[model samples]
Target: MKLLLLTALTMAAFAANSVLNRAAVGEAGMDALAFGVIRLASGAAALAVIVAWQRRGFAMGGVGRFVAVAGLLAYIFGFSVAYRGLDAGLGALLLFGVVQVTMFGGAVMAREAVPLARWVGAAVALAGLVWLLWPRGAVKMPVGGAVAMCIAGLGWGVYSLQGRLESDATQATAMNFMLAAPVAAVVWFLWGAEGAVTGVGLALAVVSGVITSGLGYALWYAILPTLGAARAGVAQLSVPVIAMAGGMVFLGEPVTGRFVGAAVLVIAGVLISMLGAQVWAGRVGFTKSSSGS
Candidate 1:
């Protein structure tokens, strides 16, 4: 139950990132690049303080750290770029679809044992996602924006895959932010729309960085090892649903019948992916024991 709650919280945090970006960059006229940079810097600062208290003194290292940092930077920048043109729902869909593919592919490459139920669940959830956010008539997609979201999805997938390798989730997340924050800030100052940064945007970015992103990511890292690859990928298929629901609740967006239906499908898929495998294993074990007896 605790793990379940933690996983749900992490997904909400992920969803909140989309909400914050929409509120700040999409509506408040905050430069996307500036929000991304501030988010990274603020997250880094918050985590650094935690690390200091732990007295870990920044021991992050090796190939895992390198991959983690690269993936983090890619996700942060690509997310900002994509959100500029894409609506919050569309952006979330693109980000998680690519993430599912990336992680499932990683599972294959690494020879991880993914159950059949998980694959079916992923497909069902993906179908629901497509149904919900596939865009209606006269909707024009900005190719660059869509492509940027794919990059963000890919980056997040890579980052998540590396998370299970970390010994200290907080310190590892801190180091990732610490290493990438400066680069993000540098790029922002060099070419970002400085004047476009608004006070509301700044506050949103800080909240996103310190709470949703910084702490959220730490919680995610802490849970990845326990989830395994296939389940983790399938689980994230819920983000778009969660994000859309967040919109209805916080942004006063009207929900439709379609939203309710799609939410059910997504939730059902998540349940099957997570629990079906365990049920199957249990049945198999029971049969083996009975035969032995």
Candidate 2:
């Protein structure tokens, strides 16, 4: 019972990131670059503190560390910038969709044995994304936001892939964030100077960094093993839905028929994919999967 509750809490925290990002970047007039930079720095600090409390030193040298840092930067900046033009729900969906595809593709490239259901599910999800991303479609999604979210998803996917090699998840993440912080600030200076950060914006960014992202991730890693791969993968399908509900309640975003249809298609597809491998393995839950939510 406690495990289930913790899992739910972790999922909510993950979804809250989208809501917080949208609120900060879209409504608070916070410059996206500033938000991204601050988030990275703050998250680094918070995670550093957590790691210290555990009496673990940071791992400063590894090729995987470098990749993790790079991927983290890309995801942070892309997510911040994308939210300036995207509703929380839409942004989450795009990010989620692309991330699944990227991870699935990576698995295929690595010669992982993918279940048939996963392949079909991936196809269905891709088709749904195509429907949503159609240039001249009924939904008329913003091209720039969609593209940025895709980049964010790809970055996150790569980060997750690299994370599998880590012996200590918290230490790896703390190190990655620490390494990425200064670089993120530089990037903000170069191209993220368009928007300004208000007090509310700063608060939102800090909470998102220190709470939703930093601590939330720690909590997730703590509970993830208990949930197992298949349950963990299936549980993430709820994030976009939670984000959508959060958008409606907190961000005043509307729910149109097109969005409803798209959501169903994408989420259903991912859920099927998650369960497919479990069923194929015959009683053993899926042990091969990526964790992005």
Please write out the lDDT profile of model 2 over residues 1-293, one tens digit for every residue. Answer: 47667867887998898788778867987877787788778998999998999999877857888887888887887887787777655676688766766666666665555666766766675566555544442454688988988899888877766655566768877888889999988777787466788999899999988988887766665664444333444455566666766988888888767767866786777666655555566555656543222
Clashes of 2: 0
Highest lDDT: which candidate? 1
Residue pairs in collision within model 1: none
Clash number for each model: 0, 0
- Tens digits of per-residue lDDT, candidate 1, 1-293, equal 57668888999998898788778876898887888889999999999999999898898688889899999989988987887788656777788888998988888887777778888889888888878887777766789999999999999999999997887899999999999999887777787455488999999999999999999999999998877777789888888788778878987889999888888888888887877777776877754311110
Model 1 TM-score relative to the real fold:
0.93
Off by over 4 Å in 1: 87-89, 286-293
Provide the TM-score for each candidate, comma-separated: 0.93, 0.76
* The best candidate in terms of TM-score: 1
